[model samples]
Target: MSSQLLMIEDDTRLAEMVGEYLGQSGLHVTHRADGKSGLAQLQGPEAGPLPDLVILDLMLPDMDGLEVCRRIRSLQGPAAQVPVLMLTAKGDPMDRIIGLELGADDYLPKPFEPRELLARIRAILRRRTDGGTPAATPALRFGSLEIDRDARTVTVGGQVADLTSYQFDLLVTLAERAGRVLTRDQIMEAVRGRELDAFDRSIDVHMGRIRAAIEADAKNPRRILTVRGVGYVFAKQQD
Candidate 1:
């Protein structure tokens, strides 16, 4: 079955062009002109079912892209967990990081090639599909925290933790090697299967977001601790 994608963008020309381009790659694209209408089609009564993925634009007429992303994450049940790929003309690193922190599965700056967009879309969807497969290791438990590797879900104190797919994998990597310190590069390599850019602090951003979800006090996280001048470590045992 073709994947369904909801594109919340005001640029009709770009949406139409991209929609047609992505349609050629086996995805069905639905375009909405503004954030409100997009959200309405996304979760309104007549919206039917949620799409497989969302391609959201940062500059919406009704609301900023971050607000829309926040509202989407605020949704309950399966609809809230729908994957999102954020797009914007802004090239600020903070903007990308903020988008990811707010549950965006991926980020892409505007003026990008259609092929790059398609590649990113495929990559995000592939992660979701691959994560559903069972892992060789069983679920890990730490105090009140539970990490289900196979299902890629985390529950803290018996409540679901709001984490993006990347954040979940990062947490699992740390948990699996509990008590061991890992540098940002090591953590990135383990989770992303690639090397990390020294200048990119996305790993740290993801860690902060994960701590917010699972820690009692994200400001002073006890589960994942920061080691001065080194990296981070998941506690061997939480007190």
Candidate 2:
């Protein structure tokens, strides 16, 4: 089935633009110009053909974007699985951080080119479906850290590590292709299904957090080594 996308934005022009753009990219697009209506549509009893992703504008006339995000997350069963990508005019660093912390799969600042938005949508969707069986999962070990493919979880010293979905994916990607020098672009595509833009710092920040969780020290991480000009690699042996 073609991926379905739902866009919630009060701006009619922007909504139309996004719908047309995404539709052209082979996705079924459903749009709502109001938050209340959008929420109702998603929460409706019929639930015919649930959306694969939600592109939500932060400034909704009827409600705060964070509140809308919270509501979407509260849904049970299938509805709860939908991934959200937040759109906002505010380019504040804090805003982006908060959005990610709030369970948004991704965030895009306003005035972005339509193509970039389309790229992001495709990337997010691809990342969601890239996983395969057995051979696909990487067996990585750093120090006492180990990632189990069958279990789909990470453990440090045999204890489960509290990792976010994205973190786990990143770890698995690097672990599976251990010792290979992967550039940022390669890492981004493998983990996020897209290239890393010049300003995209989410991966680095995420790596830092992951290191903190798995490594005895994060300031100078060892398990995941950064090659500076290039990207990063999972060491063949614990350092």
User: Per-prediction TM-score, please?
Assistant: 0.87, 0.70
Q: Rate the local accuracy (lDDT) of all candidates.
A: 0.86, 0.78
For lDDT, the strongest prediction is: 1
Checking candidate 1 for backbone clashes, the offending pairs are none
**How do the residues 1-239 of candidate 2 rate in per-residue lDDT, one tens digit apiece?**
67888898998888887788778878888888877777777878535677888899888988978788777767765575577888976567666666665657788898888988888788777656654543564556667888976565799998877555567778888988889988888887877765688877777767876887888788877788999898899888864
Off by over 4 Å in 2: 44-46, 130-165, 177-186, 193-195, 204-239
Q: Top TM-score: which candidate number? A: 1
For each predicted model, how many residue pairs clash, with residues at least 3 apart or on different chains?
0, 0
Task: Report residue 122 deviation for candidate 1 (angstroms).
Answer: 2.1
The residue-by-residue lDDT of candidate 1 on 98-146, one tens digit each, is 8888888777888889998888788778767764545476789998999
Whole-structure CA lDDT of model 2: 0.78
User: For model 2, what is the alpha-carbon lDDT of residue 206?
Assistant: 73
